[model samples]
Target chain A: MTALSAAAERLRIRSGAYAGQTAGLARGHVQANLAILPADWAGDFLRFCQANPKPCPLLAVSEVGDPALPTLGTGIDIRTDVPRYRVYRDGVLTEEPTDIRDLWQGDFVSFLIGCSFSFEEALLADGVPVRHIAMNRNVPMYETNIDCVPAGRFAGKMVVSMRPMAPRDAIRAIQITSRFPSVHGAPVHFGDPAAIGIRDITKPEHGEAVPVEPGEVPVFWACGVTPQVAIRTARPPIAITHSPGTMLITDLLNTHLSVL
Target chain B: MTALSAAAERLRIRSGAYAGQTAGLARGHVQANLAILPADWAGDFLRFCQANPKPCPLLAVSEVGDPALPTLGTGIDIRTDVPRYRVYRDGVLTEEPTDIRDLWQGDFVSFLIGCSFSFEEALLADGVPVRHIAMNRNVPMYETNIDCVPAGRFAGKMVVSMRPMAPRDAIRAIQITSRFPSVHGAPVHFGDPAAIGIRDITKPEHGEAVPVEPGEVPVFWACGVTPQVAIRTARPPIAITHSPGTMLITDLLNTHLSVL
Candidate 1:
C-alpha cells in the first residue's frame, strides 16, 4: 500500500479511523513522544528537557490550556491526534485511552519531544545498518549510570537506546545523526556496554535484545524514555503520555529537522 | 618559544635556518605531504590521488617545472620551503637532503597532499585526547588489507594511522574530522584491529605503537603514508617527498579547510 502523508495519518488518528502504532505509517515525517502535564509541573519538565537535551529534545511545547500544537502541524489537536495515550495519576498508569479530550484539563501543557524515527531514517538512507530494524525488534534500551541534570522535581538517571553495529557503520551513523540534533544527534556512547554501566549485553531494561555479532559494538543513543522516567520520578498529580510505539504523527518533515 | 607564522616557518626552512620537523612549529596552519614526480609519471599519480581521495587528498598540484606553489603561499619555493626532503631512485630512498635545489628538475611536477596535522589540531582543540600526543609517541601506522584503486602503476594496500580513544571521544573526533575531508576525512575503521587486517594492534608496520587502554577502541584514519607507499610501489625513475614528520607549511589556516 502507498504510504500516507503525515497530515493524512494524523487526520486518520484524530477521526478515530486509525488507532494503531504510528511506526512506519507516514514515511519521511517526524514522530514525537508526547507528554502532557499540569501547568504547575510543566515548568520543571521544560527545564528538565532543556538540561538533558540528548534524551529529551524538545520540538514543540504547547501553551497552558492549549490542546493545539500549532508549531507541530496545522489543525493538530493534541487531545486526539495521538493514536493512543497512557493516562497517569500520581505517576501510576491509570488507563489507556485512544483520545485524551475527556482527561484534558484547562491548565494542561503538551510537549512534543523528538523521537528516534527521524535519525533512524537518516542512518538507513546512508546505508548504515540498524540491527534492531533488521531483526524486526524494538531498539534495546538501558538505564545508564549517567545522571540527568535534575531540574525541580524531575530527577533520574539517563536511559539510552542501543543499536549494535560494526564500528565502520557506527562512524557513518554518527555523521548522519549529527545533522539531526532534534532527534538525539550523535550517539552518547559505543563499544563496551559496561563502560556506560550496562551490565549484560544480552539483556536490556526495556525492549527486546538484538545480537551484537562478532566485530560489532553496541552503540547507545539517549532514549525518549528518559523524560517518561523523569515524569514518574516527579510524581505529578496528573500526567498523560503517548503509549509505547504509538507516537503523534506530525506534519514536520524529518529532513526539515536536520540542523545542517 | 612563541610559534612562528606559516610564512615565517617556510622562510626559515628556505634560508636553512630550520632543518627539523614541522610539527608544532606553526600552530594553526595547514601542513601538507609533498610528492615530486617527473612529468612523465605525474598524470598517473594525480589520477591515483583522485581515485583514492581519503588516503591521498590532493591540496595543490604545481604546474610542470614550476618551483613556486603560488596558490599555497606567496613566493613559496617547493624546492626549498620544506624542512627536509627524501630523494628516491628506483623505489629506494637514495638521500635525505635538507634542501633539494641541487636535485631540482624543470620537468618535475609537485603535488601537495593534505596532512593529518590539520585535523589533529582540531581534535585537540575540541578536548578530544589524542593518545599518541598524550603519550609522546607517534601515531601507529598499519598496512591494511584494503586495496587502493590502482591508477596505472600507482597502487598498493591502503595504510592507516591508528589513535586509541574512548567511544565518546571517537564519536566527537569523527564529527570534527568529517568537516575536513581534505585531511583524510573521517576514520576508515575503529574497534577490532583484526577486522581491518591488522594482526596485532601493538605492532604497526610504521610509526611507534601507543597503548590502547581498556574501554578504548583503536580508531584508524586513512594515513598520509598510503600515498608514499603507492609512490614506492610505482617506482618512478626519480621521485622526491618530504622526510617523515617534516611537512611543507602552507599559509592556509587549518580552520579554512573545514567544508562546513
Candidate 2:
C-alpha cells in the first residue's frame, strides 16, 4: 500500500479517519510528543523543557489559548491532530481519547516535543542496525540515575531508550544521531547499564526488551517519556500527553531539523 | 620558554640552531611526517596513500625534484625544514642525518603526511586528558590485524596509536578528531585489545604504553608510522623519512582543519 504524506496523515487524524501509530505512516517527516497544559503550568513546563533539552527538546509551543502550531505544519490543530491522547488529573491518568477538543480549555497551552523517530530514520538510512525495529517491538527504555536539572515543580530522573549494536555500529550511530539534537542527540551513556542504575537488562521500565548479541553493546539515548515522568512529579491539576507510540505527525522535514 | 612560531622553528632547523623533537615546539601549527622517494616510485606511493587514507593521510606532496611545499607554508624546504632525517637503502636504515642536502636528488618526490600532534593539541585544549602527555611518554602504538588496501608492493597491517579515555571523553575525542580528517581522523578501534589482534595491552609494537585506568578504555587511531611500515614492506632502492618524534612544522593553523 502507498503510504500517505505527512499532511494527508495529519488530515486523516484530524477528521477521525485514522488513529493508528504514526511510526511508518509519513516517512521523512518530524513526529512529536504532545503536551497540553493549563496556562498556569506552562511557564514552569517551558522552564523544565529548557533545563532538560535532551529529553524534552521543544519544537513548538502554542500561544496561550491558541491551538495552531503553524511552524510545525500547514493546518495543525493540537486538539485533533494527534492520533491519541491521555488526560492526567493530579498526575493520574483520567481518560484516553482520540480527540481532546471537548476537554480543551481557554487557557490551554500545547507543546510539540521532538521524537526519536527522526534520528532512527537517519540511523536506518545510514545502514546502522536498529534492533527493536527488526524485532518489531518497541525500543527498550529505562529510568536512569542521571537527574534532570529541576525547574520549579518539574524534577525527576531521566528515562533512556536502549538499542543493541556492535561497538563499531554504535560509533556510527553516535555520529548520525549527533546531527539531530532535537531528537536527543549523542548518547548520554553506553557500554555499562549498571552505571545508570539499570539493574536488569532483560526487564525494562517501559517498552519491549530486545536481545543484545554477544558482541553488541546497549547504547542509550534519553527518551521523550522523560517529560511525562516530570509532569507526574510536578503533580499538576490537569495535564495531557500523547499516548505511547502514537505521536502528532507534522510537515516539518526531518532533513531540516539537522543542526549541521 | 614561549613556544616558537612554525616559521621560526623551521628556520632554526634549517640553520642547525635546533635539532630537537617538534612536539610542543610550535603550538596550534600543523606538524607533518616526511617521506621522500625517487620519482619512479612516487606514482605507486601516491596511489597507496590515496587507497589507504586513514593511516597515510597525504597532506602535501611536492612536485618532482621540487623542495617547496608552498601550500603548507611560506617556504617549506623538504630538504632542510625538518629537524632530522632517516635515510634508508633497500628498506634498511643506512644513516640518521641532521640535514639531507647532499642526499637530495633532483628526481626525488617528497610527501608531507599528517601527524597526530594536531588532534592531540585539540583534545588537550578541549580539556580531554592525554595520558601520554601527562605521563611524559610516547603514545602506545600497536600493529592491528586490520589491513590497508595494497597499491603495487605497498601493503601491511595498519599501525594504530592508543590513548586511554573514559567512555564519554572518548566520545568527545571522536567528535574532535573527526574534524581533522587529514590527521588520521577518528579512532579505528576502541575498548578491547584482543578484538583488533593486539595480544598484550601493556606492550605495544612501537611507542611507550601509559597506564590505562580501570574505568578507562584504550582508543586507537591510524598512525602515520603505518606508511613507513608499508615502505619497508615495498623495499624501494632508496627512501628518506623524518626521524621518529621529529616533524616538519608548517604554517597552517590547526583550527583551519575543522570541517565544521
Candidate 3:
C-alpha cells in the first residue's frame, strides 16, 4: 500500500491486491487476532475471553452478521480486511482463504483479540531487545500446562510465547508490557520451562526456537494462540480465525491500547 | 508507638522508648536508609547516588551540620529519630549507638536513602508473599561483580538483596516495585545467583538467607547496602549510617512514593 494508514492497508487486503502476513505493516496501528464464531456460541466465548483476559484481551465484538468493527477501525470489513483467514469445521482446519465473504454467516459474531505486536513494539521502543524479532524468526510459543479458567465449552491449557533476554532487560520488559493490559499485559512466566510444563526449551509446540544466550533467561508472555487453542478444543460446529501472523490491522494506535 | 503515624514512631525513637528495627512500626509510612558524611565527601556521594539510583535512591539530602530534615517529616531530628546508628571511622565500624548527637560534626551532611521496606509493604499489600518476611529472617544480601558508577572517591561493586519468588509473583513484584522509583525501584536481576557473581546462595555477606525452593527463582533488587559498601570503600574520615534494619521513619506514606 502506498499509504501506511491502516484503512489503506485494509483496502489493499479487501481489493485482493495484498494477502501476505501483516507484520510491520501500517506502523503504529493495533493488529488483532480474529476468531469468528456463531452467535449461539459467542456468549460463552465472550465469557471465556473475559475470564482469561491476558491471553484473550477482547478489543471488540462485532454485531452478529455485521462484518464492520466500528470501534477498532473505520469502514473495516472483518470478512475481508484480514490478509488471510483459516476456516475450521468441527475444530479441524478446512481452508486458508484470502477472504471469508462466501463462508460468512448471518448469525456469525467476530471477536477481535489483542495481539503481542503492540507490546513487542513497546518493548523494542524502550530499547529492550526481543530475541525472535532480532533473529527474524517467529516468537517461540509453548502450550503450557497452566489451565485456562473454564467458561462453558471453552476449556484448555494456556499457550505462551517465549523471548530470551538478560534479567535486566526482562525486568524492564515486565515494566513496559504491564502498561498495555490489552496486549497480553505482563509476562506470565520466566526462567525454567519445566515449571510451566514445557518439557523441552529447544522444542516449542509452535513458532521457531530462538537461542537463549549464555546469560539470557527465557521470558514468557501469554500468547494470542491461547484463545485459538481454546476455540479448537471447544469444537464448535464452525470456527474461523486469522491465519497465523496475518492479523487484522486496525485504525487504533498501539499506544492507544496502553492502560497507562 | 501508640499510633501508626510515622511522626509518632519517630517521637518514640527520639524519646529512647523504642530502639529496635523500624520494620512494621509506622505501618503505612516510608522508612529510609541513613548515611551521614562530612561536607567535603557529601558532593561525591551525592553524585555516586545520582549515577547509581537503583541501589542508592537518594530521598533527601540534608544541609551541612543540620540534623533536622524539614522536607522529610514534621520536626524530624535525624540524629535521634532513627532507632540505631553505626559509627564508621576511616571505613571501620567503631560503635553502635541509639543516638549520634554527641558525634554530630558541624560539616556532617545527612543523606536519606529509600529503603526496601516501602516496596515490601507494597508487595505484601498486593498479596505477593515476600520470602524473608514469611520465614521471619532477613532478606539475603550479596555483593555482586557488577560495579557501581563511581564519583570522586566513591567507588565499589554493587550489592543486592535477594527475595525468592515464583515466576508469577516475581513478575508482579517487578510491576509493583517499578512504581516506587525512590525505593530501589525494580529488581536489578533475577533467576541465577551465579549470573550476578554470588558464589553461594546460602552464604550471604549480610542478612540471613532464606531457602529458595523448587519452582522459585531468586529475584535480586539493588540493595540499600550498596551505598554503605561504597562509603566504606570511599573511606570518608567519619561516616555514619543506620544499623541494618533500624531506619529513620518519615511522615510520607508508602503509597505516596508510587510514581503512577
| Pairs of colliding residues, candidate 2 | none
Interface Cα RMSD, each model: 0.7, 1.3, 0.7
Instruction: Summarize candidate 3's per-residue lDDT along B42-140 as a digit string, tens digits.
Output: 999999999999999989999998899988888999989999999989998999999999998999999999999999999999999998999888788
Instruction: Please give the TM-score that candidate 3 achieves against the real structure.
Output: 0.97
What TM-score against the true chain A does chain A of each candidate get?
0.96, 0.97, 0.97
Candidate 2 per-residue lDDT over residues A1-260, each given as its tens digit: 12258888888889999887888878899999988899999999999999999999999999999989989887788999898999999998899899999998999999889999999999999999899999889889999899999999989999999998887888788888888999888888777788889999999998899999886778899999999999889999999999989998888888888998
Docking class of 3: high
How close is each model in CA RMSD to the real structure? 1.9, 2.1, 1.7
Model 3 misplaced stretches (Cα beyond 4 Å): A1-4, B1-4
Winner of 1 and 3 under lDDT: 3
Q: Candidate 3 chain B — worst ten consecutive residues by lDDT sum?
A: B1-10
Give each model a TM-score.
Answer: 0.97, 0.95, 0.97
lDDT tens digits, residue span A52-109, model 3: 9999999999998999999998898998899999888888888999999999899999
- Candidate 1 docking classification: high
Model 1 ranges off by over 4 Å = A1-4, B1-4
lDDT of 2 by residue, B6-97 (tens): 88888989999888788898788988998999999999999999998989999999999999999998877888988889988888888989
Candidate 1 on B1-260: residue-level lDDT in tens?
A: 22257888888899999998788987898899999999999999999999999999999999999988888888889999998899989888899999888899989999999999999999999999998888877678999999999999899999999998988899999999999999999999998888889999889998898988888888999988888899889999899999878999988889999999
